[model samples]
Target chain A: MKFKIASGILSDGLKKVEKVVNWKHNIPILQGVYMECTPDEITLIGSDSDESLRYHIPVDGENVDVVTPGKILLPKQAVELIKKLKGEIVLEREEHILVIKYGKKSQFSFVTSNVEEYPKLPEINFDGPSLILKGTEFSNVIRKTAFAAAENDIRPILMGLNIIANSNELIAVATNSHRLGRVILKKGTDKEKQVVIPAKVLEKHLKIFDLEKDVNVYFGSKNQVVFKNGSLVLYVRMLEGNYPSTERLIPTEFLTEITLNRLELLETLDRIGGLSDDGKTGVVKLQIRSGVAELSTNHSQIGKGIEILELQEISGDNEFSVSFASKYMMDALKSIDDDYICFKYTGNLRPFLVTPSSGSPEIEETQLILPVRERDV
Target chain B: MKFKIASGILSDGLKKVEKVVNWKHNIPILQGVYMECTPDEITLIGSDSDESLRYHIPVDGENVDVVTPGKILLPKQAVELIKKLKGEIVLEREEHILVIKYGKKSQFSFVTSNVEEYPKLPEINFDGPSLILKGTEFSNVIRKTAFAAAENDIRPILMGLNIIANSNELIAVATNSHRLGRVILKKGTDKEKQVVIPAKVLEKHLKIFDLEKDVNVYFGSKNQVVFKNGSLVLYVRMLEGNYPSTERLIPTEFLTEITLNRLELLETLDRIGGLSDDGKTGVVKLQIRSGVAELSTNHSQIGKGIEILELQEISGDNEFSVSFASKYMMDALKSIDDDYICFKYTGNLRPFLVTPSSGSPEIEETQLILPVRERDV
Candidate 1:
């Protein structure tokens, strides 16, 4: 293979797919980026057995001037070499060696591996109407809820976000049994289907979408889902299991409901959170009384922190106290994007929910956290 | 201690001394900051077995309002709490607990350890003259030569920079047998004395010095050194050893001399350095020819990198090749603060010196690196 490409354009595309390249033991070739150059465009592909990304960079303007159409599988070392160099790059294949010359003084001749040995990304089939939405909208829905997903493999099914799409609404839900996060996209449409989108895929999804353009989404064989925008395509494998019923976990009836300026309460909790960091049962206590909310954390080794924070409104909750894992609740509170936030809860041990009152690109997002069992101090 | 002080001013003083606080298991009190509040000033002191720091914050401005003078030992957690807070801070002792109140809503009641249990920082006596100089100059001299000091505890003596003061000259020299760094402070004066400053202390010294004002430096009892300004003082325990004579190591006779743009050569070497990083000898081969210098790195897995970099001049015997640890040479190159640089060497395996041609704030600094044995390839 022989071709000449601009460094900036090529490096940008490589960086996108590089994150998906597998670094697992036993399969050394998967650590390389698969490159295919044509007269019109160049395509870079990377896969890690679970997810695959194929990004195409067209010969737009003067980004690439192809001398010959060729394909080469370049390892991470070559990618690092190319990313650091400036100006134009010329790549030529000679036997098992791929000679890459960049700038004026630097030239690297790297040994090429067998590209044929690497598993091929299956061709996705799509005939029905797919959910097409703006990149920002797709990324926003993922970001609001993905953090609450279970990271461990103990319950493999819980390691994914339950994505439910109906005729006119789409909802993303993630829970680690202890905490739950939910986001609703009010303007999405698809056939009634529920899919558990792997947690790792949604993370990579956020980084790949850059340009503010429309993205197409479709599912394949119940086990695979695909996301694409003209030149870039991503396929994520789905977890096969029924997710736990979380609808009943979020209590509708509440004894108390409080409204607060979101940032003020967040800052107050962060200041008091560190006190409960020792090996004791991690609990950050929140008590509400006389139109104010007070947070406190007590640890045997690390001392105690107490803070009284102002609220916008406190109606039903005259006097109430609850204990929660500060880290889980903090994560839930941070996911909410609004100036004002609402908190609703039942009795002491009941699970509580924090939600944004209003924000731009309005969509409902609910974060629910279970209270820890209180101990006598 | 009871004092209402500006949190910003107080925390700044605490941070300087905090770095010296030892977190060793045996001496638990040494892990705490020794804070003494007076009517006019507050002093923050921290000590490890090897070094101690005392920083004073004055109540001359509106920064402090002392209610009562007292002393307390605050653990790492309390110090962390204080550093993150803003605005005014009120530290008041209530029995064994130190009640720290910040902002309007936050309060932390941290149990304080006995201040008397912590080891005392010895009083430094400077009977004769001391090496007093600008903070920037001291920091610059340390920065330019200290990197070459051996980091490991293998040869305990090589873990410090040998500082010599005779008549009007102060020279700082550090060598690990393989490499050497020397800086000549021409405008320094003290009694004829040669002392080895601990490598770790020099590192902390760089971070502690803030203002460009004068810094008073005095060596104590041939084993301890004290560095101080009006409000801040640092005492470092000196390393006891006779330093090797490195002056004779630098060769006066040169078989080949090459001059090049400092940044350009550094960049060229950096670009080629990583190619020889995979279990290879990891040497960046520098070859000088007629009016040009070419740098190359060859590795079995990551291919070969070759670059012909521009040079200012290549006088003396031009045909010469030498190999050096790319990492070591790169580090030595980065320490130099100059536009143009000159390289002088005797033979293939001989040590070479890299020095600045001309630069401002110029106290002469030299970095010498030994060549690695070349492989027969």
Candidate 2:
């Protein structure tokens, strides 16, 4: 391909697609980014077998000039090189190599891989039911629930974020059996649908919607979903298998409720969490008496750490104790965006709910953590 | 032990000494910090057996109040807890448990280790040869030469930084056999001595001399060196081995000399260095012809990158090409505190010198990198 484009434009385009490129893939062609140049625009595609990213840059006479229309495959190293260059960049194909010129005296050349060997992007038909929402709102929903998804593939369905959309609301839920995070947005589409999107795909492509713009989500072919914003498009493969029914997992009633400063509780948990000797699941006990609550953890080889937190507000049962994995509690607290957080407890071993005291009118966020049995601790 | 101290002061003290504490050590007591509370002051000591750090906080009856004078060994977890607390902290020993009270409603108890089992600091006789210099100056010397020291223990002597002091000058040198860095300060004492301090010790304790105060360096007892600044003292055990003679490694004469902007050269190397496939030792070729230079690197499976840099000044032989490890060149260039850097080459394969164009009058810095042989590539 022979084209002249601004270095900044090419750099930004490469960065958006490079996130999906598996640079360490055994197949060399899989690590290459396919570039197609036309009279009107240029398209760059990057994929890692399951997911793909496509970025389009319009060719304007001022910043971008197209001398000829062709195709070439640029390896990860070449893309990295172009990102570091300045001024305008001119790329041309010569026999089996692609020559790139930048700045006043810099020239780089890469042996292009056969463009035919690059896998074609999965066909996405946008005729299906679609939903258009504020990019920020969708990102916020993902941030609230994606972290609770299972990171391993042992339970493939649990590794995907389940999103159920109806005419009035959209609910996103992610659970790894122990903990669950759910966020509901008071906006949806005309048709009702539910799809489980890989949490990894949602997180890695979150930056694409960083700008204050609107994103269109489309349910494409079976097992395929498309997210489009401006000239950038991302195609993610949906996880197969039925997601567990988690709607009833959240309890609506509680015997005790307490509100405390979010930051204070996080600090207290962080301080005492290290005292527990359990490898990854350090257990800390929370005991509430009168208007004060104490958090403590003890290890046979280490020591004991205790911190007392003054409750801002308390109701229902006044005295109770619960033991939980400190990391889960901390994660639930950090996801809160409010100064004060409220906790509702049912029993000692049941799942507890955490939410912001002053909830967002547009989005409702709820975090649930299953407490460790006293005997287990 | 009973004492009430401001959390900030105690936190800062723990941070300084905690760097040497091997928290993952097999012996539990070895991972503890020894605290001695006397009527006049409090001393906090942390050691990993080879090096020890002692910090003294005087009892001025304001920030510190000692009710009962005693000693205790606080485990790593306890130290971490205290670092995260705010306000004044009152630590009182009650039988086997040490109760720590902070804020209004926070109280923590830790099972303190037996103070009698903690290892004692090595005794040093302060009557040995000593050199007093600015703390900043000593820290600067360590930064310049420490990175060149061998990180592996295969050659114990190469893992230490050699310091030779005399009435006229103090010289510091470190080398991993392939590259050497030598810095000389035009300040010293009457007694002349040479010692090899472990690079790990010097690097770990560099933060203690960050202030602009005067630092007293004492070559204490055999195989021991002490660095004291104000109330903070660091005891380092010298490596037991004969340091190799590296004075002759630096070339005195050169066939070619080139001066270029330091930042420009660094950027160029960084851009093209990744094109090579030699793992960590990516080699880039630099060719100087007439008054211009070209840097290029090529990998059979990857690509080729070339950058042309206009020379600011050139002397001696021109039209020569030399290849060197990009990482070594970048490290040496970063250590020079100058805008323009000068490169002196003795031959294509011999070790070359790198220095600042406007050399400092008080401190002379020299960096040498051995070029990669063509056959090796």
Candidate 3:
């Protein structure tokens, strides 16, 4: 667009939307940042068909000045070039070409794509059943479960995270069938809504949002949702199929309950996990006894590792043992940021739950892992 | 094998030799580190057939105590486990199973490979024509040229760096036909020898060596070269081939010479190089005029970038132009550690030279780039 903006401002706006740009779009024009320049503001939009991010840059910024108002689509290269250059970045359209100039030392020109060829970004609705949560709370719930989401699933619905907002709590759950992570947080809202979004969509926006600020989320119709905070807006398309009942999947009863320092357990799991069999099958045994829990992995090809971690408390059964994929356990253990974490399970094959404690109402978070079943081996 | 060694010391020793362990070895035993523990010292050796590194961990080091003498071959897992654990690590063999214990909290058992299965390290002779140089000097020369070594080569000999010890200089040269780097350091040795060593071997050893200390280089027989200093020893196989005479390839007479700040030119090259047609075809033109050198990359698909840099001096034709792979020029320019570098060329089609100057003769370094022929494009 024919506009002069601060390099930093443009770089930040471009970065937010760049992640949503469909690099593999059938029409190459869709793989560009669509910019609309008006007398008061400039809007940058990027979309990957399923999701989009639209960021607005006001003209009142300290170093930005609008020379003219126009619309154009700039490729990733133009954004990258501006990010590296210093001082004011001036963009002027010459026919179909966009000329980018910085200081007096350098100038870059890109053949601008036809803005009309780009797909329209998903519509954003400001009024809807919404949820309001601190960015950190929202991010934490997503972070705990996103990793458990199926990466490339045969059942595509499993690739999305099931998000439910009801009453004062917002719960997000993700699973790849083998393991599940459910994070429940207080959103301070009474609105109720349920939607499943691609884990990747949440992951991308998580990278940019300032976790300390409040993020407003709105459900747009049944197929779309929008997350907005300050000048940044994210649009995500809801999955069509049904997500499995995650609550029933996480077992309700336990024969044993053990509490240990989260960091201590994480470190121990990491060491034992180091000797995983060929990286693919990282099954390790957790022998919980009085005072200590022994984490061990015995692989015939690689080696064997036994890590003894001191337990904070133990109850229910005096001694118990279970086997699980070490990587899955480590992921669950690492996600918990608490002084002590508790583990509850009923049988060796049942999915165990890992949480901060059995009685913490301030914040609710739980991770469930299905043990590496002996039958599967 | 049978010793109580500090975790830090053992980890450091394992790290140095780990690079030599062949990750892609067909026989898993060959990838193991052969360790021999004596009453006084523990020797750790790793070999990938062509190259090897042997590091000695003395028992007298802090937190180390030898209870007995033994030998065992430890796999990557065992070493990695010990590297992560803290406190004193005790390695004691229980028959064929080697128990690696750290403090009383953790223990990892690796089924030791038969000592006879691991390949022996190359023989290192002390009484040979040798040269000594500060590790920094040795590393600097390698750093400047290693990147030019053919990564995947039809001419396998080009994958190695031709090192010549003649009269009073130790010169190292590497080229992949497209570009060349020659580093000539005044080693002040009279011994004459020439060997082409696989650049990858030097690169691995360079990663572990302390650049500030002195490194000993020994030319063993006609097929092997050994590098050793303090507790570290590296063995590299020497290639046998007729290396092209590098001295003749560098032109003494030139039609144009331009001098500019090395950093300034490098930065400008980087910016102009960013706009390459595609990552694969990075041709850029250097237009050297009276007072300024204009670096530009004009690609029909990716667009064009022009960077104007001030020139300190220019001679011959008032303006001359030449094109080369922008990445090659940037790599060569970045390697020169000089405030100002001089460029000398004869014609657009001829190879050009980039060096600090004609006067700084203490350690002469030159980089050459062959212009991309217009006919080839």
**TM-score of chain A in every predicted structure:** 0.93, 0.95, 0.93
Docking class of 3: medium
* Candidate 3 lDDT tens digits, A114-208: 88787776565665538776787778878889888898869888899999888777888999998888877766556578899999779867978
lDDT of 2 by residue, A235-298 (tens): 8989888999998989999999999999999988988786755433578899998679988777
Error of 3 at B251 (Å): 0.7
Q: In candidate 1, what are the lDDT values of residues B207-292, reduced to their tens digit?
A: 76865677788877646788887678888888887898999998878887777888888777766776654522367888887677
State fnat for each of the candidate structures.
Answer: 0.71, 0.71, 0.83
* Candidate 3 DockQ vs. native: 0.66
Q: What does candidate 1's lDDT look like per residue over A56-142, in tens digits?
A: 888654668777787889877678778877888898888778888976767888887987777777777644536876887877778
List the TM values for chain B, per candidate. Answer: 0.93, 0.95, 0.93
Model 2 has how many clashing residue pairs? 0
Q: Interface RMSD for each candidate model?
A: 2.9, 2.4, 2.5
- lDDT of model 1 at residue A137? 80
Leading candidate by DockQ: 3
Best by lDDT: 2
DockQ order of candidates, top first: 3, 1, 2
